[model samples]
Target: MILTFCNQKGGVGKSTTLYHLARAAVASGRRVLVVDADPQGNTTEALTVDVPSDAAGVADALSDASTDTLRDVLVEGVWDGLTVAPTVGEALNAVRDEIANSHRPGWESRLRRQLEGLKDEYDLVLIDSGPALDTLSTNAFTASDGVLIVTQSTKWSLDGLALLLRTVDEVRRYYNPTLEVAGIVLNQHEALTSGGKHYAGELEAAASENSLRLLTPYIPKRAPIKDAVDFSRGLDEGDYKARPLGKLYSALLEQIMEGTGR
Candidate 1:
């Protein structure tokens, strides 16, 4: 299945969630491909080791003037069962601008076309999108089978959730009819804090209002989770403190698989 882990708000741990989820998928022996559609390249940096600065990437695949296909930019991931279509600095941003200003037709479907021939190569494709509902995000939405919305349990994040859902509705209506909301993941939650609890309740109400599923066991604010991504290691590969978080991601992945019929 092709899933885009998206949120229009930055610092919500979107990339980190996708990175760990990809690791969990790899640990389960599934072949996974991570498409780093974000201009920031956080996912690419997490998944690859010692990549060259000028490596061809998703921007090359999406660029009208470039001959590189998605396959051409795929690099070996840290895990054996994983691969990545990485993005370098400023390239994706430039492509986004080009796409936004272009007079060409079907600008939104460029990433979808790029993924068509490559979908069968991996069991799962996870796209880490930029923190905006702009042209690049439109391409990600157009290309994806479903979207996994990631957000923090905070007032600002909750406010952004409404706009994000509206954008998803628009994408579904115009670009990809079969696209669905895989689920909403509440990342970096502080379960004991009053503020976290209050916002989480609001989030639940928002999900219910929109008929969306709020994934269980909200990801906590933990040092180990951050460390795992920073060290370029899977949570399961980390010390005892990180193993439980790996299990949480594994459960979330299972829920996603079941929802998407994978």
Candidate 2:
């Protein structure tokens, strides 16, 4: 399955969620490929070490019309069973420009077609998109089988989700007709507080209104998650896997696996 972790608003944990999902997938004995379509390259940075300065990556593949295969840009073994097609921060803007200006036959569906060629090699493909509705983000939606919408338990987050869902609807209508929204992942959750409860209720209403499942076991605001991102380390390592947050992610992984049947 090709899944894109997306949200228009930043700090909604899109990159973090993708990173964890990749780790979880690897732990579950799946071969995973991650596409870092986000210009921020947070996913690329977190999962890999010593990214070569001269490597031709996802941005290069998207921006260059001559690029034919994803394997030319793939970085092998970023983790045990994880491979990455990384982005160089500034190069994605060029990809956006190419997609906008190129009057080509398959510009929008380029990523999808490329991944289709390698479908047999990976059990799951995860795309981490930028926190905006840009060309690269559109490419991600077009390329994905399903989308995992990440949001916080807040009103502003709901507004972003509305915009993102509209984009998803357009993509389904005009691009990938079978594109499914897997569910909404409420991240950095703090449901015990008064404001948290209020926003949680709001999220529940929004999900029901949109006919999206509110994915179970919301991820709480925790220090280890922050530290894992900050330290560029993984939480499923060593004793951390036994922590509450790790167990939470394990459950999240199980839910995702059940959805995808992986």
Per-residue lDDT tens digits of candidate 1, residues 156-181?
88888878988999999999999999
Task: Please tell me which predicted candidate would have the highest lDDT against the true structure.
Answer: 1
For all candidates, what are the clash counts? 0, 0
lDDT per prediction? 0.93, 0.83
TM-score of 1: 0.99
Q: After superposition, how far is residue 201 of candidate 2 from its true place, in Å?
A: 0.9
Give the CA lDDT, 0 to 100, for residue 246 in model 1: 96
Model 2: per-residue lDDT, tens digit, 1-262?
A: 9999999899888899888777778877899999988988788788887887666788777766556377788886456898998876577777788888987877788788778878689998999999989888889999988999999887788777778899999999999999999888999988888877899899999889988888989998877887776666557763544356766777887897688666
